[model samples]
Target: MTPTRKRRLVAISMILFAVGVATTLTVFALQQNMTYLYTPSEILAGKVPADARFRIGGMVKDKSIERGQSLTVAFVVTDGDGDMRVEYEGILPDLFREKQSVIATGSMQGDRFVATEVLAKHDENYIPRDVAEAMGKAHQKHNVPEDAAKPSTY
Candidate 1:
């Protein structure tokens, strides 16, 4: 082949290789930095990596909250089958109450979740948008109102 043609082909191949490398690196970085949400039972079943940052969602067990003189609060999060204690030192959401759904984010330290943040469900009928949408579809399949059976507002 001519030298000029060979050189052009090599340059094109190099550019394609560079693009592939950049794309792969971007994907790897995103995966490494992504966080996932799991339920309390999922955590108890060892579905989560021990040291990776993730979230756990469940109902805050009734009367499980222990408030200290300071801002520290300890509570048990349960997903029916299992429970995990979480410790946090920040003001909880206004809707945070006993027996309410909550999502805690952090890492597992031993058997406990040292939560860096806690998100409480807003109201009785208020599931997280994602959860609500999923449940809505499920309810539609079963011929039920998505919000009809929700706990009464009082």
Candidate 2:
């Protein structure tokens, strides 16, 4: 009702509006940059957006590593329930090998995953939580023994 009161109300309203806008923009930017990790089975089942970049985690299928021209390499990643073919044209990590856990960051190109970066499990004792859980679920679905379902068995 008073001029001073009106000015104070306007200032408060503008501050609130600016804060809301900043919060909304932060959320939008985070969503755009966020990458999800999926299992090979989930990807095979069409759980990922066709053109969205994401990470796939699984064990490198035994004997599936193939070297190609230049730095190109191809391999199959399996979570025991399903497999995905991955192609990468960069130098793979030193620990990258068959029968090891790997996380490939890329997008699907038709049936195959075209990876921009490939990460190998850092050591014998460490497996990514997502990969470990996916492997355990797959093994349990197949009625595997509890001991065999452990990520340490990798």
Candidate 3:
């Protein structure tokens, strides 16, 4: 093969290699930060990874909020059919209250979830899509009418 042709081929090969490496690194970084959302029912059913971090979405169970000393709080999150206890050591959002939708990011510690961040529904009329689907699934499992599971505003 000609020297110029060989040089062009090497250059093309190097460019392809660099592109492949960049693509692989991008995917790796995304995977490291990716957090899957799980429903309370899914968590109760042991469908989540035992050690990996994830987000749990559900409604804050009524009368389940318990305030501990300092900024610690514990509450039960429910997706209608199942419940998971969540412990968080941070200031909860003002909109956070009983029966409100929430998504907590953390990992399971034994039978409970230890949350690093807690997100409350922004308004009475809005619910996260993941939480809504979870609630729908729970309702379906229990044979509860879908309307009954929805908030009164919806």
**How many clashing residue pairs appear in each of the predictions shown?**
0, 0, 0
Ten contiguous residues minimizing lDDT sum, candidate 1: 130-139
Query: What are the TM-scores, per candidate, against the unseen true structure?
Result: 0.75, 0.87, 0.90
Whole-structure CA lDDT of model 3: 0.93
Sort by TM-score, top down from the best: 3, 2, 1
Tell me the lDDT of candidate 1: 0.81
Model 2: lowest-lDDT 10 consecutive positions:
137-146
Residue-level lDDT of model 2, residues 34-146, one tens digit each, is 98988888887788987999999999999999999999999999998899999999999999998889999999999999999999998888888988987777666667686
Angstrom error at residue 51, model 1:
1.6
Best by TM-score: 3
* Candidates by lDDT, descending order: 3, 2, 1
Query: What's the lDDT for all of these models?
Result: 0.81, 0.91, 0.93
Best by lDDT: 3
What count of clashes does model 1 give? 0
